[model samples]
Target: MSVLFDRIALIGIGLIGSSLAHDIRRLGLTKEIVVATRSADTLKRAEELGLGDRYTTSSAEAVKHADLIIVSVPVGASESVAKEIAGNLQPGAIVTDVGSTKASVIAQMQPHMPENVHFIPGHPLAGTEKSGPDAGFPGLFEGRWCIFTPVAETDETALKRLRGFWEALGSKVDEMDAEHHDKVLAIVSHLPHIIAYNIVGTADDLETVTESEVIKYSASGFRDFTRLAASDPTMWRDVCLHNRDAILEMLARFSEDLAYLQRAIRWGEGDKIFELFTRTRAIRRSIVQAGQDVDAPDFGRPHPLDKK
Candidate 1:
């Protein structure tokens, strides 16, 4: 619980950055927290919320004496933020990111990082559908996974120190190569968001079904998709553009499986449908058993089945 860093600078005061600020202050992780964002209104709001000891609109100024710097911007803006802070970074600073796509973030930020600094690309697999500075709260990362895609030339001591910081925040930390991390996240995170957006869009485009009817009759399955679809659009757009290759690969595989299910339904193959459903149900059970999620229906919410 002692100070892990003398000063920690947060670039982009959105959900992740603000959440880190809350946890850092709550756990006494840093002597000072410098919060920076491009928007003046957001900077003012961060100050009002007391999320940091110092607030600035300039990223470079925020990191002038910061020992640890976390970039929480969208992946598309990673390069510009890196360029701005590259010249101002203190020697031996630990630079990390909370980007969803690791390879693209590394490609954009690594080149600009100074040789003395440790540029570790990381993704914390934790969030809600909400965003903005107000959406952040303490314990957001507790029991979640924080994966670091460290480069070959990364300093081992710096990496361990960064890991310790996340661990102190109650996160389980792991490391993987950038390419493999991208591939794994494409299916687990990217594809699911893409599917949710697509499904919601399709429902919206249904000419025969009135909007009110769709809302009134929405079942748990459709409601869950809406929750994922409600995530920050700018961040998801950047994720899609940055991780195009891996997402396309997963999309192709998803299409093939969808076609198989379509063929089975067309042929009235009840056994095939039942077999697939049974297998998928087991996967859900495994997730619950692994402590990743609760076994309660509707993600631990009240379901129609519980009404009676």
Candidate 2:
């Protein structure tokens, strides 16, 4: 694909930033990629990975001439990043972010953006339980949904350009308002991660369940939860803080449902258990049928089961 911009600045060289860099390089999405991070150590690691053409610890300096600037950091850092780079961003530059909490990021960043620049908040519903520059890999966004929660009165041309950019990286783009995006992601992404983290913590706290035994007995189900628990603590903490309301709402519902399930199990209500289990299994089947399971090993490939 042809390069979309002369220079693209990434203002956080962690998992998402480095993953964007990898895909940009792989797909030849930009003429120059400038990687920036708050930590000098991370910048150095990104340099070693050859994730970009230029590396810097200064966000302002990195965005100076860039036509596209992506702020790929924790939601809590959005304000600082916006303050640092607001003046340096090129006029008419399409600025976007890959922050998890949409409304909070927009709240933090929107005030600092100048009229000449486009500030669109985005969240890619894709990631692994990994962090840092080295954890990134190409094709991370391929077939993944990148949700752009554009504020009202957002520049349409700039939004279109950003859509093109993510498309070039093999992402399918969708748009929603910031609050709706937050609510939806709270149920789908945030709740699951919180549950995983809680479950792992619960297991760790059990006196009868030895740590060694937990480790030794972990099969596919427990192993998946472990992956979510292994996600970057700082990042997850920031997400929980920034998206507090939505997360709390989802958590409340989750607790209510869990209590019902627990009651059913304790009473040996086999029919209730069977009904809920069957419904949940049907949901998974629907996902498979819709081809929405990108994390599945057969993504973008024919499944042997399909042939059968």
Candidate 3:
């Protein structure tokens, strides 16, 4: 793969930014990479990891000579980052973001973007219950979906170039309007994380069960919820705030379904309960079939070797 851009600036050196740096360098995606983050320690770590050709604590300086700038900051910080780098952006630079909430990011960053530069809001449906530079690894986005919510005045050339860049990283790119993207992600991503956090919190606050006992006998279901709950609090907090409307809408629907399930259990409606479980099990099988997850037993966890 040839260099897609002469220079690319990463505005936050967290998991997403560092992962992109790994792929960009490995794939020869840019001639040079400029990494900038608000934290001096993160910038120092990024430098030590050799994540970029240049590292700085100033975002404005990072984009001054860059052809492409990818913002990897939390959703709530989008506006400030945009304001800080708006004056320093070079002509015809393509600016994009890896934010989870598209509409809010568009609202926050779009107005501050220069008319000459292209502002494309994007979300890569990929990540783990990890954060920071050390948690990032190569091929993190391979085979994952990268959705773009391009603004009304988005340049065709710029959009195509950005699509190509993600494709070169082995991602499947899709486009949707910001509203639709937010609504879709509300249920698919946001609500699940919210549910996980809530369930974990309930367990933590349990009066009948001891904390050590909860850990000692954690079933797969509870363990999975804890994994999601272990994610970065700042990022999830920003996501919930930025996509409040959509998240609330999804939450209401989920509450209705949960109430129905509770009613079924209370009334001993076995058929209804079985029907719902069967439907959800089918959905899990479909997810595995769709290449989103493995079909192996125990969600693909490696088995321990036995010594006879």
Candidate 4:
């Protein structure tokens, strides 16, 4: 298939950025791939990985003449990237992002977009616990969800081109409003990761438990939580800070439910416990039934670490 883009510039070549680079190469979706990162060392590594046709630490230089520009930086750095590339973007170029948070990214990037360009904010609900260029792999977004929060007057042709880009990389695309996308992700992605980090931190703080003992017994159930806990600290920290309001709202609900469960346990109300557990189990079933592939742990095939 002919590529939809002549050049695709990827800023911040971490796991998500590098993964997109790999898929673009595999699918032949772009005539040339330009990689840019804040650090010169990371840019060198991306070049070493052969992930891009050209590499630079200057985002402005990288995006120049590129038909598609994807910013894969942390949500907090969105504005800086937007400012850096705003003047360099070619007319009619499609500017999108793979940030975890939507509303904030839109707010940051929209102001910097040129009138001739399309600034469509997007989020791909796919990533591994690992990060960095070395940790990325091809087909990471296969069967995954990529949500686009289009502006009220977004260009249809640009939106269609971006949709085709993601679809070619094996993602299922869906469109929603920025506020709605932020709210939905807060519950489904942000809160779960925060809860996992909290639980792991709590376990690590236990006075009676040795770190080695925690490691030894982690295989039972805690290991699953640890995977999310082990995610890139800088990335997750940015997410927590950027999506504060929605995350706190979801956290409040989570705490309320947790308190209810605790009350049931304390009062020996087995019926309440059973009902809540049953409901959650049914939710898992519904997810699987909706083609989530739950049999394969962590989204698709089980992580290699779990095989041992």
Q: Which candidate has the top score in lDDT?
A: 1
Q: Which stretches of candidate 3 lie over 4 Å from their true place?
A: 306-308
lDDT of 4 by residue, 51-89 (tens): 999989999999999999999998999999999999999
Off by over 4 Å in 1: 303-308
Model 4 vs. true fold: TM: 0.95
Per-model TM-score versus the true fold: 0.97, 0.94, 0.98, 0.95
Give the lowest summed-lDDT range of ten residues in model 1.
Answer: 297-306
Q: Mind giving the per-residue lDDT tens digits that candidate 3 earns over 1-308?
A: 89899999999988999999999999999999999999999999999999999988999999998999999999999999999999999999999999999999999999999899999899998899999998889999999999999988889999999999999999999999999999999999899999999988998999999999889888746787888899999999999999999999999999999999999999999999999888899898899988888888777766676332
For candidate 4, the clash count comes to 0
Q: Model 4: which ten-residue window has the lowest total lDDT?
A: 293-302
Tell me the lDDT of candidate 4.
Answer: 0.92
Write down the lDDT that model 1 would get.
0.94
Error of 1 at 302 (Å): 3.9
Could you arrange the candidates by lDDT from highest to lowest?
Answer: 1, 3, 4, 2
Q: Find the 10 residues in a row with the least total lDDT in model 2.
A: 294-303
lDDT of 4 at 107: 84
Q: What total of clashing residue pairs does each candidate reach?
A: 0, 0, 0, 0
Positional deviation of residue 167's Cα in model 4 after best superposition, in angstroms? 0.9
lDDT of each residue in 1-308, candidate 1, tens digit only: 89999999999988999999999999999999999999999999999999999999999999999999999999999999999999999999999999999889988999999998888889999999999999999999999999999999999999999999999999999889989999999999999999999999999999999877888888746888999999999999999999999999999999999999999999999999999999999999999999999988667787677789
